[model samples]
Target chain A: MTIVITAFERSPDGGKGLARDTRVRWALEEVGQPYEVRLVSFGAMKEPAHLALHPFGQIPTYEERDLGLFETGAIVFHIAERHTGLLPDDANARACAITWMFAALNTVEPPILELVTARIFESDKSWSAQRMPLVEDRVRNRLGQLSRRLGDAEWLDGAFSAGDLMMVSVLLRLRASGLLDEYPNLSAYVARGEARPAYKRAYDAQLAVNKPTAG
Target chain B: MTIVITAFERSPDGGKGLARDTRVRWALEEVGQPYEVRLVSFGAMKEPAHLALHPFGQIPTYEERDLGLFETGAIVFHIAERHTGLLPDDANARACAITWMFAALNTVEPPILELVTARIFESDKSWSAQRMPLVEDRVRNRLGQLSRRLGDAEWLDGAFSAGDLMMVSVLLRLRASGLLDEYPNLSAYVARGEARPAYKRAYDAQLAVNKPTAG
Candidate 1:
């Protein structure tokens, strides 16, 4: 059976591939898997059908044959688990890589998301300006520690496994904010992940969906 | 080799067991594993030694023999992987359960953390009140959908597993916020998780650490 994933019909990012689906796409591309995209409008996402697949009414749900999955971390993990290149053969290394994956989502992404909430959703609020700095500081704190640990290392761990993939994706949210530039190594690390051919393929695919249609 | 984990020397929660270390302690109890706790002061968390164990300078890092791990998600996941009770034996169920784990941390926890940041760190900011509603809405949106899916169901997937453990942990952040009561099912669900023997043991252990003179 063909693998199918849901994406935003019109992404809030205007097709920058920042939508969670992009992560799934990148993973599939990395594993050389062919898949189909099912575009979902914001309204459709909130409806019962989509809610059945994803309780949170979010984009980027994965369905293949009898298996249906939600949560990008889980989807990416599933892809990495079934495929060889995304995870190491060694048990310890694989465990470490999985650790990074969780770290990226659980530790790194929370602050970055806060930055988003402060900047976009709460931008109109009276305290937006003052609150942003605190949010940014929290992001920086996480990044600083992450950068220190990553000091001069190529990837977060032994090799570029799903961990790096997820970490880079989480860090990418900070790119537009310019806060990522503060940590030179972290910035370069994200660039490295983006420079991958698989990432480019995924980026282009989402970008295409984001493009405004010509009259 | 005996497994060792870290906890706050003096928890700010004052024995309420809201500290991150409590989660790790709970996971160990769930797996029926006896582990040692090495309490660290907030000052020590940033030192080189603790930093080596936890890049983010946070609590509840795990170490056994040569393996060292950080991030509560990673540590709990490690325990779940090593122990049988935390994860299901079926492959698909296991994968779905793992998906819930990510959903808890990645999707659900972000907004809850925002509420924390707004109240604790940014409470004095001009936009705090205005920004809070948005964060609360985001959380409610997640919880609403989750409640609908969990409607009349005992657990997220089949039987309770690591996924519920994580989801419960994520939801617990909302306890003080008073938002959890908005959805009766989710409230009851959290209560159910708390009622677990493992969760009680974990909660009591952290509470013990916070007892006066324990340090």
Candidate 2:
């Protein structure tokens, strides 16, 4: 069965690789999986057909044979569970690796997303200016704790498992905000992730989709 | 090995079963596993000892033998994977179940949490009144889609899997917001979850911990 994932027809990020599909694509590349992408327009995403696959009407919905899944965390985990290279063989290590994945999505990403909402959605609001610092501080607090835990380690845990993949992907969103620079180790960790051949491939692939066509 | 998890010494919700440890305890109950709880103060949660177990410095953290885990999503998932009853046996169904778990935490919960921050953390801010409708509407958008998918169904997918366990838990947070009542099916879905014997036991247990002592 061919694995098919949905991506934005035109990413809001405009090829920055911040779209969730890039993370899913990167996971496929890491696992040596060849997949197909179906681009969905922002309007069509909310249609009943797309909503059937993803109730939230979000991009990066995964379909292969009879199975369909959504949510970047789930897609990435589904890929990692089937791919040997993405998870450790040791039971404890594997469990711990899975822990980091949740930590990235649940604990760390929320504040970062709040910052995004503050900047983009509420930028025109009267209170956006006063609220920016509070939102940024929340991200910094999480980054500080994450940096301390990382503590010069190459990854969040042992080797570069799905945990690191997810943590790096989530941290990448912070680069533009410059909050990540406040923690040098996290900056280096994300840079290391970007340097991976798989990440490079995924980044290029998504960028091509979002890039403007030359005249 | 004994399974030990941490909890808030005094939950801000005052034993409303929203402190996250209740969800982990609920999963354990579904699996018929007895566990011990370690209550930690807010100050201790930020200290080195707790931070080592949970980088984000929040409860509850899971410790069994040498392996320790954190993040309510990860902790609940760890328990669900190691035991039966919480996850389905079918491969595709299992994958879909996990997808809903991610949906609950990543897609749906974020907006609700923002509403939480808006109400509790920033209640005194000048923008709180003006900004609440926006935050609440974001949560409603997700809920509308969720209600559509659920229709008359009892669970997010098939059976009472971890997906429902998580979705129900996540939606429970919205009860205080009253956003859930807008969708009758979602309200009923959460009710079904809370009506479960396992949930009852978990709820009562956490309430015991948070219940104030008589003078």
Candidate 3:
């Protein structure tokens, strides 16, 4: 079956590949799967049609044959489960890898997201300056732990898996803030993820849509 | 094999059942699995021993046989996958159910968590009152979409799977804030979850530890 996924018609990040579709695309590329993208404008995303697929009205939603799914964690996990490239053959290893995926999304990403909301949406708020440190510190605390766990390791667990894919994606959001630079190992880990051939392909694919066109 | 999990020595919520461990406990109950709980103090959770089991230094962590897993989502998922009651047999339905789990943690819970930080951690900040509306609105926005999606449905998907288990747990956080009451359907949905036999057992178990005793 041909897989069809959604992406932003024009990403808010303007081709930085922070938009979530890039993550799904990266997963597909890593697994050597060919999929089609259906772009949705911001207005259309909130429409009933998109809402039917994703209750949160976000991209990207996965559609294959009769099946439809959302949530990058779920989408990526589904892809990883069906494909050989992203998960370990050992059951315990696979479970551990999945744990990292959850940690990346629920634990690591939430604080980073708070930081993003502060920097972007709440920048004009009176508390932005004073509250910024608190938000940043929360992120640092998680990163400090993650950095220690990931010390001298090529990936989160053993070889690169969906766990690394997600950890790297979540960490990517921290790159612009320079928080990622504070931990050399994490910075190197992100660099290693970026260096992957599959990640490069996924990044270029989303960049194509997001990049500005010359008149 | 004996199944062992960890919980807070004394939950910060004082038996309100807001801790993540409650979610895992709920999952185990739903699946009819018997488990043991080891309580960890706040200081102990940050120590290297606890950090070894859970890199983020939070609980509860699951250990059974040779497998040790942290992150409530992953632990709950592991339980659901092994048991019949928490997931559907259909592959597509199962995948969709898992999607809701991620949606609850990643999308819905993040904004709620931000609301929590604002209310609890930053309550004394000068801008707390002014900035709260923005944080609350972000949660309200997600809740509005969720309320609409959940309209007239007993669960997010079908048949009270882990999706409902997780979605209900995430929504429960908003009850004290009175935000949940704004959406009658959501409030009822959470009540429905609480009414389940498994959920009741889970609630009572956590309450036993958290409820204060008179001298």
The runs of at least 3 residues in candidate 1 whose Cα sits more than 4 Å from the true structure, single-residue gaps closed, are none
Model 3 whole-model lDDT (C-alpha atoms): 0.93
List, residue by residue over A31-88, the lDDT tens digit for candidate 2: 9999999999999999989988988988999999999999999999999999877889
Residue pairs with backbone atoms closer than 3 Å in model 3 (clashes): none
Which candidate comes out best when scored by lDDT? Answer: 3
Which tens-of-lDDT digit does each residue in B63-167 have in candidate 1? 998888888888888899999788998888888999999999998898888788778876886666766777789888889878988898889898999899999
Per-residue lDDT tens digits for candidate 1, residues A150-211, read 99888999779999999999999888999999999999999999999999999999988888
User: Residues B140-191, candidate 3, lDDT per residue (tens digit)?
Assistant: 9999999999889988887999989999999999998999999999999999
On the 0 to 100 scale, the lDDT of residue A202 in model 2 is: 100
- Displacement of residue B139 (Cα, Å) in model 3 is 0.6
* Chain B TM-scores across candidates: 0.97, 0.98, 0.98
Winner of 1 and 3 under lDDT = 3
DockQ scores of the candidates: 0.83, 0.89, 0.94
Candidate 3, residue A89: Cα displacement in angstroms equals 1.1
Off by over 4 Å in 3: none
Model 2 DockQ, alpha carbons vs. true complex: 0.89
